[model samples]
Target: MKKKGNKPLLDMLQNIAEGLGETLSPFCEVVVHDLRNPKNAIHGIYNNLSGRHIGDPATELGLARIRDPEFPPRLSNYANTFPDGRKVKSTSIGIKDENGEYVAALCLNVDLTLFQSFQGAISQFTRIEDGRVHEDLERTPAERIHARIDEFAASRATTARSLNAADRKQLVQELKKEGLLEIRRGANIAATHMGVSRATVYGDAK
Candidate 1:
């Protein structure tokens, strides 16, 4: 049972949830559960990503809290997927009354479909292992070195000039893999174009 002053805290959290949902917009869903009544525990739902509304029954996590007195105060960054295969990253925070018993919970679910699409695109474009020869029969070593660097930056959705130290190191590794680093003065040309010293490239090569 909720204590006498529990209503005010729950109401405050509900208001905070409403503002959170509004600020995060289309990608985030926020749900508030009133554990006092598990059958219709949803005090409010915002963004509606899951298509659940107020008066909806408590979710599995909420029910677990009710059953286990020692349930964690917060559970965060867990994975959840919808019926449509939309992926969600979620966090649940349990709220307690003055008696230290769980009385409510605030849950946030963030849809990762957009991010997943970007990840897939990155994987497709960055792949260099097609088991085919890309070496130009007539191109000079300098031209091939520059071309490889440019390709590496493009695959990562960035420009070679804007590549950071870490990016340059990775590029050097890829260059070594493609046998460009074995060419005479290949390391010097790469260092010059990449705005890094020859030693930096060699250090990364190791």
Candidate 2:
């Protein structure tokens, strides 16, 4: 078995990190890990957080990929915490070669502290009536979806993940009533937050 670096693929990954970093800038950090070299797996990093540098050792996930050939390829948004106590949300994707070998990985970490602070500030400002009542204008579609999910989960006294089929249906109906499902790609977004599939979301929407 011959193992060699894939220049084209690496270049593409680098470009992807750079592009995403540019858009999210200071809030997002993108890192590329080369599985072939575990000791120095960090081949590239953009919008650096965690104060990590190129040639840094593999992360826990990177090491896991090295050990398990059947490791999941894609990891969706999940919570993380920095050493300095900053909260983060992360997603990771593993790249495989023709031989079904994990060759590289791309991970994105988004700092949530700034956004939390910003949300708090906005909440305070919104609370102060400016001579006119403005509708809930500060929250984005995703935020709204998350809020509704949280509210539903609270009502059931269970986590969103614990929502049964009936619970999900009711939650979906509530979301639809709030006009959340009417937004572009709203079903997909809501499904992701509700920990359900797009097909499930569609069924509930109907």
Candidate 3:
């Protein structure tokens, strides 16, 4: 162990870890490790996601940095796992002293379990059916049928309920040919719009 007394640098890293942990709250774990003391390198831990405590030994990466001077100063978005196999995305940053010796590290670990579950749910919810009818959900069948009748009546200079017998018979025949009289409760719907009995609408449709 180098056993350097760089309390200010370690304190700063701890402060940063605390702020970041609070900002990302309950999902991220931020840890500050004092590399000079390999046996008890964990100086401070915030959010405590991995269930590690202060005074824990240096991690593999931290130990590597302590031994090898040529190691990369930063590793970002690296894949990691917790003790129980929970997935994690981690970033490890090695802090160096003024003499260019590795002094401390600030690490961030983000728990991705919740986000992965959410992604799966979203994918399932948005899955498209391969074969489905094109449906008009904005209007009911009755409203569309009434609108069609009103359009047909307007062309004859009358309203749906004011059509003469000959005109009304022609309307029912045209509606039947268009399959409008084949819908559910077709005769009743036609009667309501034509101001006639359902039997009259059915008879006219034939």
Give the candidate number with the greatest lDDT: 3
The models' CA-based lDDT, in order, is: 0.88, 0.88, 0.90
Q: Model 3 clash pairs?
A: none
Give stretches of model 1 more than 4 Å off.
1-4, 126-206
Task: Report the lDDT tens digits of candidate 1 across residue range 140-159.
Answer: 89989988999888988887
- Residue pairs in clash, model 2: none
Q: Which candidate do you rate higher for lDDT, 2 or 3?
A: 3
lDDT per residue as tens, model 3, 11-105: 78888999999999888999999998889999999999898989999999999998887889999999999887899999999988767889899
Provide the lDDT at 182 for model 1.
91
Model 3: residues with Cα > 4 Å off, grouped in runs:
1-4, 134-206
How high a TM-score does candidate 2 get?
0.60
lDDT of 2 by residue, 1-206 (tens): 24455667878999998899889899999998888888989989999988889998998988998788899999989899877899999999999888888889999999999999999999988876577966865988888888889888999899877899999998898888889999888899888887889899889878
**What's the lDDT of the predicted structure labeled candidate 3?**
0.90
